[model samples]
Target: MDKKTILTMVLAGFLGLAQAQNNSTIAEHVKSATAISKVLGDGRKVATVILEYDAPISNRSLSPDSYEVEGKEVVGIYSNRTPETAANGTDGPYVVIEVKAEVDLDARPAPPTEAEMQEKKERDRMQGGPGLRAGWSTGGSDEYPGNAVVLQKKEIRTRTGKVYRADGNPIVTTVETCPVADRFTQEEFVSPYTGQTLPYNIFLPENYDPGKKYPLVLFIHDAGVASGPVKQPLYQGNGATSWAEPEAQARHECIVVAPEYPVITVDDNWNYSHHLDTTIALLKELQSRYSIDSKRIYTTGQSMGCMSSIVLMLKEPELFAGALLVAGKWKPELMGPLDRQNIWIISCEGDSSSNTLQGEAVAIWRQQGSDVSEATWEMTQTREELSEQADKMRAEGNHLLFTHLTGGNHRATWFVAYGIEGIQDWLFEQHR
Candidate 1:
């Protein structure tokens, strides 16, 4: 249950200019870039690197905030190594370092050069004429270079003036592509029952073969509010995209179906009676088309999606092996059927009183069960503690886990739950 730090997969030349330098003593321990996250509004990119070395690391030298990209000072550093104390060596031989920098703010596109403009003009002429390509281009323009946001390797320097260059090349591309084979794919799910076509994102195993059966994770996305439009799960929450991330896909290759529900509904209901039917129909259609392990199907979601997941758990418990419901209320009247399935409910302290009350309902329900262990999350458990609790729950043959996130934002409760180390693995292990 140790929460393995999730690293972003940076492709070759991930640090384009950074890798040009000769490898140094530090480069000997350099591993691939595990992950990168962008805060567009903040004009920064947080990149994580993994290093394995025999010698002890200099705390200040390895600190994430101590590194810089293109001379922009790193705003913060977080290392997932032993004792979080200053320069603690007990936690290492291997360390994961998160380097945060204003890479985007400094990499703003420069005005196009005359030569480039002429080249674009000529290319446009060949394609059909001046302004034609620009008109057709989705976001490209003659005013500036399109695709200018290249993820280059920036210079990495410590606070003490020491510099380090990557000895390794990028193993993945930062440019997001569609239908990336074995990765998240955007496609239409045609429901034969309603003759309705819904847009959805599915992640297939990298080594997918028709001959093999894989688990199916049906993620129902929260619908924001009753008045908003229905969006794809990935749009609903970034965490939903994690199912398709290289890290998650690598850990447990499965077929993840995130369907978009129509926005024309009352009270933002996602898992209501009629919608549940359509959702199931969608699932059936997906199953018929893909190599899905019928017994290993699972579902998880937040808010509206969580409600939907709960409804599905009740109406069609036979269809799912497990369910993780976050930031949603549970109806006691309908609790009768949930006992048959493996369920985990999570909420945050910042969540609405209704969410916390639901957790209490789950706790009360657990007391009536023959096999149940009740623990208050109080939003205070560390990641390690959460993992241990997850282990203990599975060990005790408990069917329900209600955890309260005491301090995080309620809107993001699901994100943190999804980030938990063994949660997804635990769900995947359940089979009817």
Candidate 2:
């Protein structure tokens, strides 16, 4: 008989056997077997048959892991595998062939008992797993013996060598570590061209000697801020603060030259063009007096001060090794015409003015094929989360770094941006 006729006859016989036994048969298992044989057959005198039975025969169950049919008298069974009596086996009647078949049964795990669920809920509540217990503060109390149960505690010693909490908690509140300002000799220098008396607050390193030449960071203040000769009472704004003095000088290991602009503005408007001339004069005067490293000199500023740095770069790109512009606007037309310089742009996402201007500058710089690294401060997420994303980007060959702060506004963004760990190390790594 033909292969098609043989297959039809075998299917009819299986259907008859299923009806006689009062058992439902699946036609799909037989159809799959037939399809497999047809693909494997090489024009040999072979036939494919579909069979249905309560238990699969030993030869047909070739592989427990793979789905296939083999051997003579292949009987396809769709039922749960269980040890049963087999009269023909050497292992006795209790040894039965294992068979795996699709069966309808409950596959889900049993629901927890009421008492068990209540126990778990209580355990979670004590551990502050979630929900209402999330805000439960432990404040370094010894009552919470387990380290995992303590909310937030860090080891710290006060200036007086007293053991205290570093991170803020209920028991140990955050203590401000404001340092005494280091005394430095003040000097005034006259501008050669304009004859304008310009004063610079020169901070010599703690271990300063006349023989050593030191690296310098020229910090410029924004408009209406007098920061040169007279140390004005510290007003915090534009990403800089008086607190920055001790931290920056200690960490950077450099002398800070903060120059003041007399009559900070020529007219009512804060014109960077006018202040640029004064800055140039002041830098020259400072260079004459102090043994400053020309190649290692860096410039950075906040707000209008940042604008001044950009203006200085435009006039004399070779003056400084690198520039960090924070929350400042740069004119796109002027930027395109300027020579390439090592630039690091920093701005918060909330600062609309800086974001718009800096975004434009980045695009233009990319088009010009200039080397620039941008560090952005986004206020939507925490710092740790943003650092993770920044690390991923670094892996993907992008120079942009991001510092995200939770509950950060435009004003407070710079407090974290400039104060990022190893910021100066990253900044000075490259010089052009």
Candidate 3:
């Protein structure tokens, strides 16, 4: 072969090797596998196929408007309906793929240009909001070693509609439905007090009994998915998934209610207090509709939702038996009434933004004669360590329990906070 042809063949071989390695690494990160299935439209013809991967799929492997099934080009790709975190933490791998109408196989957009990359960096820095620091965006140039090509916030764009494959005949893959999603019933409540509507997801305990009163845990979503869509909280954060696990249900046997309100609660600052009144009304309605233990109602939230939970407690301390606030600060204005409620505060030492707030809350509770105790926790701690901490907190005879977790990132710390053993049991033990 000529010298130019020889060089071309060598480069192609190297690229193939690199791709194989990438796929291997991606597979290892997947705790469970992605479930892919065709979505048929009118006449039972293939319209789209849902791709549910346990980990984030690489943009290079599945780019918008570039996927294909049996040589039939995918017309578009959509992921807006996907939950922000899916089953994993925000930084963990959990992806949902949507394939739109079809186009010619040759119509895929070219690889992102240098100009496009630069533009996205600038936008993500300015408008990417809180979780941006988690390195969710694949940064640096493509030539940067180990820097995978992730779709930047600005690069993820697609339309939702029907488009046919070029050949009018598309092969499809099928899989079972997601069991996590199957158990939830999507619901919306209209508050008569404020006339405001709130969408929520409710998971009924498998052993639910109408005549018997069971404990209820009200979970609030953080800023990202809370406002734009109705069921965003069901996927964006760990609170929903944490409570949905069969282990949790079997242990607690309580009803779980996750409310999705309209408005970004936490961003540069936490502000769920913006719609506090409407939220209170929503809870009142839930209480009337279900057989809830009046003395065992509990509340918990992360970030923005945490801030709002504090406000909710301050205004209606008599309503909640206990609360666990994660990654949020304590507002001094509400300090006066906080001691009335049993509270567990969790924050990561690395999350400097919330450390000061947590400290202030802890001090105030102690000063007010509300029993208070402090402890350190790490995600790697064994079950024995977890139970020991729970025992110590209970012995302190304190109204407030403060835990500082190490070895966790600020954006994804909620997963670690909720995963600690005996923590939920502690919440369940409290009574008004």
Candidate 4:
């Protein structure tokens, strides 16, 4: 059977402050500013802005009213060179301004038109491309800024007690930093067993030291992005980026590996592919190359990727401490005692395909005394409610976690699932 790949929704933005020309003395000194973005549960937003000044500025003279930001609210202002707030004093060259940025990144892309599809098919035929024509991915949209952070100059007192008003438009010229995913570097992997090549994006923790060991997360993409591009796994959904986010890292401090399989790794019937073999090879190579905590290694994926992750765990159950399977399922008979291992199965309540298969598998696990913890959550619940339930389950000491989400569908289930910090926390806490 041909692998029926699942395509995913894509909602992808930046801020600017490059040149400020005004009559005020401070205007001449202000060349531009950099906007730092962060991926929150809602989407991507400008977390802070770094103003580059040619002279020293007093923190006491700077306030939230010192600048007018378009489409954003300035919460507090500081002249510290670093992103963090500092004591009120004279800090030189750079000023960090905190911005209130909470926006949603959940827009879904429209399906292709008939003409567009025909054009794409013709192009594929001309190029002799491989793989099913339906595969899609989110390559780098979430990591890079998609919208702008506009800053407007206002009157402010300099350190010398001199007042200045440039009253000029401050265009945000650069987006120099992104939290967590910023540390990810692009690399390639080639299988020594099958000689097949795969391109992937890898994230290492800050101040990585070989003297200490860090846990690792292996994120597999859904069929949606398997054939799209090299880094689609990172952009397709939060599956790859969630565990590496700053808050999650603060708790787990692990490495992340996201590969674009470029081919179907498994079919709906559990037919396997060579890419799975290469994935295992890549993981083994990474263990030898980095100080990865082997006992804490975990696998998580969506759809086709989810099934492949299960196959990986089955092929070498000893290599995985736990697994988070989202929006995907396999037959209970062919699952091979995996219910006895640490696994969490999550699916949207209304997704007939996923729910039917997952329910059957969970039933089998329960029959065998797998001691699973099952919960149904509303996708509209506030973070506090979700976290509260997650904390409760975390304390249950069960190896299997099955969550059925209401008010959500299959494709979008992952978007909300990855943003659930409570579930991420539980994943990190598991160990062999």
Candidate 5:
């Protein structure tokens, strides 16, 4: 063959080899795209999945289109989400191209199969005994006529993790058809010493009758707030009205009596001791009218309400079963005497004042030899995590439970802490 012809043939063979290599690189890119789809079946799992291909070519070029997944019908696309060009003096036109595929998890109902049902039953059997019960009880009262008021109680189907309703009913289980009071009744009692008439809202469980005595809870609000409009002292908002009322009542089957502290700030400072005195008086009078279990009386408060709770427990430790203090500060010296009582101290990180106070109280409680459990958590801007942490704390133990929310502000933490479902659960658990 002629020299020129031989050279031409050799050049053609080299060109063909280079083209083959390019095709192999593209095939590898396709494989990577498929792997990405496998990783992101549901878009909710990840926001975006990116696949990169580095080629030897000087000019970085991406495929115009993406491969489609079969059966799943998910589409893939090349995204110039981030384009990076090579620095000067670098190889020609070389760039780094990243292709991203966005997949969203479908929101569809997943019907439980027979196997799932059997698995759930087996799981429940393995868990053994009821998970937890809410509501007040006279330590398993037998004299009280008929079945006791049972609110939130659940039989779980798993030991790992499960979501439950506010009433402690499992969401995955058969729907509970239990009946509850349509509208709670309110009763007021007047304290002659302070000339303060306190209102207590009574929640009668479904089929409630005056013939039987029921367990009771005394809820106190911070100063400057009344039970409600009209000055009905006994008509203060219980769990059923203020926030998560139904959940609170269901979890702790008791007549929650929230009394309004007089609006007067004693001596121009917040003196809760006086308000607590009136509360005790009002409670004593109610005890005479209602069959309240003196041993099971529990106290809980938020912010100023929490302050009053500490003072009340200090002043009359013998009167309460336990106390849950949220975002409130108290001197260890003042709480020293009440160390014999079960106490829970909660605070948020953002509020340095309350946080410092809470830390001091915990330290004092420890010094006094009180059994205390504390859990401090980070709070998001939305306060969702704070609520979750409070609920978890309430569920873990009813007596002496403290939950700290990280990044939470003072005001928002109080409201959320007071409204947690676990609060009532913790209160009632003391009776056990």
Candidate 6:
């Protein structure tokens, strides 16, 4: 036999010997698995799957192809010591599989047929809005509720170069992963005024110190997430989570609160429910519990939540220092002296009612002796561009800034609007 063939035979013999020595199958050694997911720019995505072994596992290289996650693209595979403090391991008990995740609300396969296009057109006409997307979509929510992962039985090698066939029975399994959204502790408040209960998700900054005061962000959800599962809004968009993100916290650490209402907060006729009042009540309760900077309290929301925010601003103008209202509109006549308040209203030019009505509110504010700075920005503008526009307005000493995003639509407006750091900074700077 040739030298190469002889080498191959010897290597196969070594592998067989290694396999015989390592009698524990992979499934037998697996203790547990945790699936890790995180919020992306527009929505949340599954990011990693980690499995724990029964004993300390020697560090070894494992190809990503050894694992399969349903509907996710595996990007990396490595050994881990723990889910948290999860640095790559030298001799750890965990195996990690990282994946490229897609958002659940926007995962539809495209190249829509003519029939689908016509249906989308008809739906747009019927709904009278863009970005409705022929379904109850809000450009928010996690892509994976529970993804099935498989550890395929295959030949793998140890760091010492010993090869073994990773035998396993029933490779399909579910990993229990913790999303950052789960960080928000679930709580409820009973309003004294309305005798109503408001369920909310509150995220206190890590290492929260009561001696040091922190600002609080009140996030109201759109009609899409107004119904319960209270965490819907927390995962739906960046409204609440953006404030609590590590990067944002590194600059300005604050608390985030999101209230989920069982009923719609507001309707087209400008009517509202008692839930808004209870939301404020919940805020007051939070203030009594935590050391909150009352002057810097901010309120923000989208669609129904935005409308509810307007109502709150009008109801107790003294309560909030500023408001970030997105993709929503109020009757110009119903709009109070919102001009006097530090308000930033964002809407896409493609959103007819929101654009027109929000424009009217701006015009009304301009009429009310308020210097409002208005900007019509392109949808393609970089974050720097948006920040620059916002900076110019803030520097100009404008209380109300009206930004009309060109060529986008209602549901997608908040996803883009909330990502601008300038807006978040401006909100933090406001005081009652």
Which candidate comes out best when scored by lDDT? 6
lDDT comparing candidate 1 with the true structure: 0.53
RMSD of 2: 31.3
Write one digit per residue (lDDT tens) for candidate 6, span 1-432.
Answer: 122322333234334533433543236556554555565435556676666666555556566576666667888777655533234555556666778764332332235567756765775676576544212333232232533455544665544555545665643334433345766888888889877677889998878999999999998877665444767776667787778776677778889998877766787767777777788778888899999999989999998878889999999989999999999989987785787789999998888999999888887877777888888877666778888877876787777888888877777677678757788888888999
Q: Tens-digit lDDT track for model 5 on 15-88?
A: 45444344332222111211111111111111112222232222212222222222222232332222221222
* Per-residue alpha-carbon lDDT of candidate 2 for residues 1-432, written as tens digits (9 for 90 to 100): 123433343344434543433432232112111111110000111122222223233332222222222222223322212222122222111112222221111112235567746755775688557322211221211110000101112332222344322243221101111112213334566766677666655667667765776677776654434322233211222122322344455666566666555533221122443546767777776778777777777787766567778778777878887766766676765677443666656666666766776777677767877644444435443546554544443444333332333343444444444444344555554454
The per-model lDDT (C-alpha) reads 0.53, 0.44, 0.57, 0.69, 0.44, 0.70
Candidate 6 collision pairs: 35-177, 104-143
Indicate whether candidate 1 or candidate 6 has the larger TM-score: 6
Model 4 lDDT vs. the true structure? 0.69
| Sequence-dependent TM-score of model 2 | 0.50
Q: Which run of 10 residues does model 4 get worst, by summed lDDT? A: 1-10
Candidates arranged by TM-score, highest first: 6, 4, 3, 1, 5, 2
Off by over 4 Å in 4: 1-28, 41-44, 56-100, 103-106, 110-170, 205-213, 223-237, 245-250, 263-273, 331-333, 350-352, 382-384, 419-425, 428-432
Candidate 1, residues 303-368, lDDT tens digits: the string is 667777877777786999988887776565457557667888787777765465675566557665
TM-score for each model: 0.59, 0.50, 0.60, 0.74, 0.50, 0.77
Worst 10 residues of 3 by lDDT: 36-45
Candidate 3, residues 211-256, lDDT tens digits: the string is 9898888887665444444545654445765665666776777888
Worst lDDT run of 10 residues, candidate 5, spans 136-145
Model 1 misplacement above 4 A: 1-182, 225-232, 235-238, 264-273, 363-370, 378-385
Hey, what RMSD does candidate 6 come out at?
A: 10.7
